[model samples]
Target: MTDRAVAVRTAVFPRDTATVSRLAAAYHSQTESEKVERALTDGDAPLPERYAREIAEPATAFHGRRVVIASVGDDDCGMVVVAATPTGTDVSRLWTTPDARGHGVGAALVTAAIDDAAVPVRLSVWEWREPAIRLYRRLGFEPVASWDDREKMVCLERR
Candidate 1:
């Protein structure tokens, strides 16, 4: 792994949107993509149409959320969207570039989300994302009743 401790900072609007827009877009693309039967090459992914407006207006899109970017040295590697609630902190989004995987980018992002959170920090991830589920479990998140309506979503909480 790299020697750098992943540094995280909350994204500032207008000035920072351009940089994070691409990352946020990638996150949506990856999450919406389907797995192949066999021998299929990963093609250029199309951004999910539903997120078009959000990507277009991040200033208003993340109205109740916190966009925290994770960087190592000078390069931004991952991001997480957190929202505080009366019961707990909800981590609605977490994403890391493929190149940054296995190097603690995801962990850092989640840790940053938890740093200022209330007693319970919650998140909902797709059932297929085993690696992400493992990472959350390692960070003390346990399976909880889903707060999301999406299919195959597994909700978890850290208290």
Candidate 2:
């Protein structure tokens, strides 16, 4: 189901590899930018080559992950990745384009992914991303623990 407010259309990737890959490249770029920022903050060097390779060829990273994409009409707005874990499904990635922010794109994508899960959903967000944390909280995800010094893990049980 598409979100009427944002007019977001959600789909499982690989089914439409060409469109999904293009959208995925955009998502990858956004994620890499965030990674670079985090690297700078942590005084670590950014792995440009690795990022490029991973984005150019996503099969390895997406092997076991279920990927979902959101689009507004013909324009891709965002994407999310969920993988089944021992305890539940792990939401490994969620990214929205700048133009898609404040329009429910992220929420739509996340909700669609979580709705398809057979178990609880877990996710980790960078501590500095207050907006994303707030979004997760609003969606009924509770803080479970600190994944690392930089990220906090949250979980949403099936309801």
Candidate 3:
């Protein structure tokens, strides 16, 4: 008798620290300039140290309460991290490497994150980024708040 193998397509969990680090580095590389940073609507302000504690670390604690979607193909395309909050789901970060733009990966990742959300969703972005703002609007995210000298714009999505 011969043994048989089953073909299954499954999601692979990110495990390598270096891979995560490289993803972070790739994410940062896209934001280091004014054009991209300004597009975040998050003030284009310098990233505070707390952001790393609250956003970057892809650890057990994060995975426990949040859902992360990585739009990877050909390379790491983009990533979205959404954490459950008292009011709703908070989009911690929605980043795409420069190499990943114009590929619809960002939109797909955002959709995945929202679909995975346990509740209503909310996210803050930079106002100067017309493309992102338009994308969020298309996704039903309406403005809820503003911060960072009016550069940061927060949006919400309700059931």
Candidate 4:
């Protein structure tokens, strides 16, 4: 699907791993940056070491999952990881790069993640990520009972 300046599509493994890994690292960096800002995590380790497994093994890091990529022109700027569970499809790692914010990249990615999902689509986000929560809620996700054990995590579902 294409909207605004963004183009969305399922990521093809190996061929897309380079792009996926790059985005995943950026996502992880943003996460670490947030956690550092909130004092939830320390930046003692190197950036790559902090996300070594994920950056090094995009395919296996999120095993058995579908990855969606969003791009504007030549810049691949957003991604989400989708996986099926007994309950419903779960969405995670949804992110829009810093430079690509507010251009419908995130919405397009969420739409792609849910487009072919089974039954309801589920996702969890950190409570502090108000922008992400707002976007998810705007896209038909509603607050759901906590399904994750992480502190202050907000679970939402769209059925």
lDDT of 4 at 153: 89
TM-score of each: 0.86, 0.72, 0.66, 0.90
Encode model 2's per-residue lDDT on 1-159: one tens digit a residue.
Answer: 244454444444446456556666776566556657766333254446644544665555577776777777667767787788887787866878777787798888878878868567777776666788888888878876455454333433433
The lDDT of each candidate is 0.82, 0.66, 0.56, 0.87
Candidate 3 lands at a TM-score of 0.66
Top model number, lDDT: 4
List candidate 4 stretches off by more than 4 Å: 1-4, 45-51
Candidate 1's displacement at residue 79, Å, is 0.4
User: Candidate 2: what lDDT?
Assistant: 0.66
Higher-lDDT candidate of 2 and 3: 2
User: Across residues 1-159, which tens digit of lDDT does each residue of candidate 4 receive?
Assistant: 334578888888888989999999888888888878878767785665536777888877877888999999988998999999897799999988877888899999999999878968989999999999999999999998997986678999999
Residue pairs in collision within model 4:
none
Candidate 3 whole-model C-alpha lDDT, 0 to 1: 0.56
Model 1 whole-model lDDT (C-alpha atoms)? 0.82
Expressed as tens digits, the lDDT of each residue in 1-159 for candidate 1 is: 375788889999888887678888878766656332221224454554547655777768887788999888888888988999998788976989888899898998998899969978888988888999999999999999887886678999999
Count of clashes, each model = 0, 0, 7, 0
Winner by TM-score: 4
Residue runs of model 3 more than 4 Å from their true location after superposition = 1-16, 35-47, 52-57, 60-67, 72-74, 147-151
- Positional deviation of residue 38's Cα in model 1 after best superposition, in angstroms: 13
